[model samples]
Target: MFKTQPYPHQQMAFDLFKDKSYFALFTDMGTGKTKMLLDIAAYKYNKKEIDCMVILAPKQVVPNWTFIEIEKHLGIPHTVAQFRNPMKVKEKEQIFNLYLSKKDIGLRILTMNIDAARCKDGFKCLSNFLAKFRCFLVIDESTSIKNPSASVTKNLLKLSRKAWTKAISTGYPAPQSCLDYYSQMEFLREGLSGFKSFFFYKCFYAITKKIRVKQQTREDEDKPKGFGREVTIVTGFKNQDKLTDLLDSFALRIKKEECLELPEKIDIPQIIELTTEQKKVYVEVAKRCMSELAEDQEITVTSAITKIMKLHQVACGHVKLDNGDWIDLPNNRLETLKNIVEELPDEKIIIWAHYKKDIENIHKMLGESSVTFYGDTVDTQASLAAFHNDPKIRYIIINPKSGMSGLTLVESSLNIYYSYSYNLEHWLQSRDRTHRIGQKNNVRYILFYCKGTVEEKILSALREKKQLSDEILNNITNYVKEGMKV
Candidate 1:
């Protein structure tokens, strides 16, 4: 039987961006954002419509789109380049050569980190190119634009007027406060022009308080206090069901859970065959983690496993030492994770890690085949697109702090916890990447932990707190509603 694909919700995202002037596809992460973007690009290119498109993204993931995500999903062939190393005169010349005459090339894809975009030459060149071409500009994970003063943000808006189309894609655009929404919505041209600045938007949905604080009653000072006004917390995007209809006019968006029917849990283990010397250190670390960390600590299987995972990190080569510095050890966790991914039987998988060091090391090990979105990859939309693209990615190593909450990674059922983090919020959001309602498979989380450590203790505490968190959230929602009645 032919499988029915792209559940209704996903199809809607695809249709929403077909012809809109400016809009955003705020689908959750793990949703099929990458696939939808590919389809949109292909549909436009095939019609001989647009000559070129530029996807701006964070540095870490710019490589993912050029090397992996685009090739894997789009039917159209496109030339892609990384916009880093622009300071090198030779590299700049090469990039210029690729950008020459889009009429000859179907789509000239350029990716630059947000930092480089802040430079004078980078901003000028990008602005000039967009002004010359009939282009579609997409900013993925658009929250990076929330800071109105950022040069990249200013440059993007300057270029936006020249583009025939513009779109923003984000999973959680407003993670912190309503104030975050102003700059994002302003870039999308979704907010009122009269409210031209972030301050104006903040004033629209915020209350101010003047306060003076005293230490030992020695001094008093006056300062402005900001409080959130009644705002809609869109756990999902607004009018989600109608999203596709809206996008068909300008762009397309898809959720992974709603599209690809894959496995629920992917169990991958990086077998770290320790060198004889490293093994000795690993055993010692494991012994200490178990006895000292878990002895007085109330532990569960999950917590015990988590501690071992941290101790394993010490063995693998990288560990956050007590003094806040990360030390390199004789460990192979990074390589092991890659090996486990390499051996996977050709299925989609989601790999989660806790630290930036791990993310970069894992990226090095996995090569350009995978997409990474964490703090390192923040402030760009292209990285967001790479994550959403339908690609044969071996791993998606992310910091729970950055990759968690706002995204949906439900495209692959096999979730591998290569390492654990300390934040309960990040843990919950990361797990939901696979365990959300769109999933049809029995989801399983395979965690790799050392035999013992504080990491394990943290994981245990988070697990217990998770249940309590749900209750607290529910209570908060009710409280907010009741207060609104007054």
Candidate 2:
């Protein structure tokens, strides 16, 4: 019942979990987890086990499942509907009602962004559908619900209880900590982690300590009346063996290296010399951040992140002013990117940038030779098709957050990071877009950063966190302060 032949690893994963009621695919990016999920759905549909399938994924990824994945992998005749907007309640209900009225024996597939589940209308619509049909629910890139406190996570957990079967899929399941596994597991099946609440789960698996610090008082508050507050911080993890045993029971964990003989992933750091204007702007932002840090005895994480993001933005050639306007600073980074593009005229390249302005600038520089995949791109699937099929379209400019997960771009072996965020999950998932199965040539990753700027500091932190698997943003204040020294 499969349209495409599965890889050996994919076939094994399918055989193992096809009949399971609840499971997780901790498969590496570019390893065809999507195909495995579709194969399972097809098997169940053929057996008359499920009347429909509901896939909840990131906004950009939701479209691809309907347009590309199911069309490529599933052999069954199915009716597919994509819920793009959460505000269109009436339209969504009509689609669901149409599906309910249909008496066809074919599988019915509904795809929607996980964020929609948080909205009242979207949640009610999906709830009603689940109430009527026996659904095989899947959450792709399951990390979106890793936060237990998020409204979307809570709503999904509740909705998951309605499905006949469920699965969660992601390349990097626990990006920051073992704590990330808590809510994702709970979404698959409540108390899957052996703990009912995140608070107790954290206490069981995380080694934490409490420290007292002077609390920040409001400007109008009396300073003498302020008291210290004790905060609990995770020092490390515990019970790893038990957690591994639990996950191994229901999760198929596979890495690219273990299952596939993929090409080498070579990382190259391309250091650029900042222009006079760029250097001046970067230094000003760094110094201002240092001064602010010096003045604030207790800086909130949000304030620290904003200050660091300002410095990183300046390093990336633009700065957002107090009025929310972005002014470009003269920088050699774009010129360097052009030079690299010219040097590889015939090669298909993927250029990743953090900002929309960067994607726009790169798109303009490449002109007709480039297609863009970002949040603002009107037709992401069309852009993806052009990149995959057209030889003349040699460049794909993308924002990592939007184009990072659930994509296979083996057409390009070279990926240039014009800019990137501090999120390690984005870095890892984006890198695998070209390096996954079917890649013949060695994958080359080029990272661009300005010397003696926040860009360099950000790269350093990313490297360290990539190795350590720690949260990079937790140390943003230190990165900003060190950038000023540089």
Candidate 3:
């Protein structure tokens, strides 16, 4: 028997997954959810309890699982397979056969982006496989299943029925509403059982609409048909400790603050002040946008603002210029990032960007000394190999969507989010890439945002959403109504 030493939190998580058929690991960002999950898979495989495991995540992250997590965390030797988009029936048949031969393999891990699971055939096949072999289905960044209306979310509910055990992992579960808990809890089969009866369960925490009033024109009246009543889950840090003891039977969660003996972090935004020339151009562009708006023409002010930010971003030297393309700017984030990493000891650092452009810039700045994983790549095996084998490679610039979950980059405890995206789920998962398992040192995560711009506003809104601040949401509503063009 290949025995593996478990981190305190990993052991706790493994224990929880042992008995619970449906559960959640609401561990914070930088917690070791990925390693905990693999440990659980190993245990189940050893016990012959499950022949396979399916990890469903965002598209940006699916590749990382195949290339990184399975290799890094599953201490015991295990053969893993990947499911690529089947362009032909022949490929589908091959995947089908691989899925059917699950029992023979000690632990078969199939990773797919949540989008793949939403397709009718994909859902049906997954459902069939689960029914045939008792499996463990772990949803990394489980909030993707938060919405009931989304096709993927619906498919997850349907596909999850086949799993002998179901687990959801997320850092910030309700980044929007306590109602976010409803679908997640439902996924766990906690109280509500399933989605069809969710409305009935909702009645327990929501109030019904009783009246409606029209605007002064008496033409349109917007009235709430149902409003949520305050419903709080009494689980806190204390209960979490108790829950851990119980989870020892099946699941584990590790917080970076509690377990990792990492370094003190200094997270500072290296603001790239716009050059005078760029500022002049930006102001002119903004003026043009406003002029277009005045003429009742559709203008993506959001995109326009993004352009201004890009211009400032260029001033920082992060932008690239190609032949016959628009003026190529440079990425300042890379320079600041290089300085930050140079300050650290010889250990490697993980750099996350929301765009491929940033990845290109980071690549150009770092040169052959660095490696990256993004959308436009073949030979996935080669990319992973380069990263794993090269000891001197100091930085790995990754697209957050592509590198966040199911990847183990724990060699370095320092992670920097160069830019942010509105997708709370991706941001949460990206931080954990370096914070999860094998990290003996404490980890520091830095989020860089340009102050006073729409970027900052979005970040503020997201943070407030996590707190479920109705006042903040109301203010945002007013701000959007006033400034947003329909």
Candidate 4:
């Protein structure tokens, strides 16, 4: 009773863990983890195992479950309720009550942002629903609850107790380190890692070192005294073989390269020469940052990042001054983008920018021929639909922060990075928006950076970080294989 045919990997994942009480799907982005979850839900519902399924996802990804994936994949009748507006308490309560009171035979589905589940009222509504109906609880992009001390993680752990089945899904589960798996696994099932507490789990897996830091204190005139304090920090991770074995027992990990015969990803770097005025501003910003560093005895990472961010902004053709006003500098980045668009006149292109100014400027430059999917867009779904369905819409200007996760932009095989963030997740997820399943052509990622600026440095750093992350992932995969042999 499936609407769309499932990929072999998706079917394999569902078949393996559909009946399990708890599992993790460590599938890569664009590998259709959402559809697999729905298939499992449908299988269990038809068997009278679960009366309802509740999906908790990011604020941006919540709607896709109700509007796209479920409608496209689930063949059985289902009543869907999505909690989009967390502020509408009365409306949400009425909808919840209506669903709870219904004597219908169809499967019940509710999707809500993970952020909402952390709140008092939102949690109350969900708790009430769970209390009334049998639920298969799933957390999409489960990394949101990676921090064990977070209130939302604690609340979700409590809520997980009520579910008949539980699952957590993410392309990159351990984005930073293996330590991220602690709270996420705990949410799936407490003591799943064999360790009773996070502290013990950390001690077992992490190699930590003690370091002394000078603690700042206000003594004489609001700031002066600095006393030394010792702190323990994670130097590296150990016992990966054991950790991989533990996770492999209950998790299915799939990478796009291994399962899909999809098109190759081509990286094209387009360097833009900054205008005279832009170069002047960039140099001035760099000098100021250096001066600030010289003046400050101890510069925090936050302040240092802020200083470097100014240099990035300058390279992007605009800089925010100390007075909270933006000064537009001269740059050829937009002109270069326009020329690239001209060259790809017949093809659809996705333009990604980190700054709001860049998005606005590109939108203005492209005009009606392009649609924007970002924070200021009134209807992101409509924008996405137009880009997907309309032939006239050849360009889609997007902010990676807003349009990065859970989006399928297969209509565009060409992705141009007008500006990018330092976030590796943003870069990876945004690139996959087009490169994922159903994309026919070889996906080309073109990055535009000003020559000899912080933009170049940022891109370099992202590549190095990605390489490190890939190495770690490969090591884990090898360890998992070795453990399987035993």
Q: What is the clash count for each candidate, in the order shown?
A: 53, 0, 30, 0
lDDT of every predicted structure (CA atoms): 0.59, 0.84, 0.60, 0.81
lDDT tens digits, residue span 1-486, model 1: 101244566567656665555667767666656566666666676666676777776555456566767776766667666677545777676577667743465577666765666788778767876877777777776777877788777777666778776777766555444455556556656443337666654554555543322222213223223222222222222333342353344433445555555555444333344455555555565555545432322223344444544554654457676687876666556666656666875767677777667777777877767778676675535545565674755456667766564355556677777766654546755776676645777776766654333333444556565432323333322322222221
Model 2: per-residue Cα lDDT at residue 86 = 38
Off by over 4 Å in 3: 29-31, 38-52, 59-80, 87-109, 190-254, 284-349, 377-384, 391-394, 413-417, 422-425, 440-486
Task: Name the Cα RMSD for model 2.
Answer: 2.9
- Local accuracy of candidate 3 as per-residue lDDT tens digits, 1-486: 215466676676667665556667778665666767777777777777777788887766576677766786786655565565553777566556667663555576777767778776667667776777778888888878888778887777766766887888877776655456667666666444333565654454444433222222323224342322332331222233432354343324446778766555445445544444544444454454345434322223243344334433433334434452445443345566777766875767677776666677777888777778777755544565677678767777777676655566666777777766555656666766665445676667766654434445555654444432333232433332222221
Candidate 1 residues lying further than 4 Å off, grouped into runs, are 1-10, 46-49, 87-94, 190-194, 211-398, 401-442, 446-486
Worst 10 residues of 2 by lDDT: 465-474
Q: Give the Å error, residue 284, model 3.
A: 4.5
Clashing pairs in 2: none
Residue range with the least summed lDDT across 10 consecutive positions in model 3 = 229-238
Off by over 4 Å in 2: 86-98, 210-222, 225-231, 299-301, 390-392, 464-482
On lDDT, who's better, 1 or 4?
4
**Model 4, residue 312: what's the lDDT?**
77
Q: TM-score per candidate, in order?
A: 0.56, 0.91, 0.68, 0.89
lDDT, candidate 2, 1-486, per-residue tens: 679999899999989998999899999998899999999999999888898899999987887798888998999978788776633787567476546665684788888888999988779868987888889999999999999999999899999999998999999999888999999898888788898799999999999987554565575344553345667877788999999999999999998889899889888999988777876777778888878777654545456667877887888888898998989888888899999989987899999999988998899989999999988899988898899899999999999888888788887899999997867778778888898878999999999987776667668777665622233346656677667654
Q: Give me the candidate number with maximum lDDT.
A: 2
In candidate 4 the C-alpha lDDT for residue 469 amounts to 34
| lDDT of candidate 2 at residue 252, scale 0 to 100 | 91
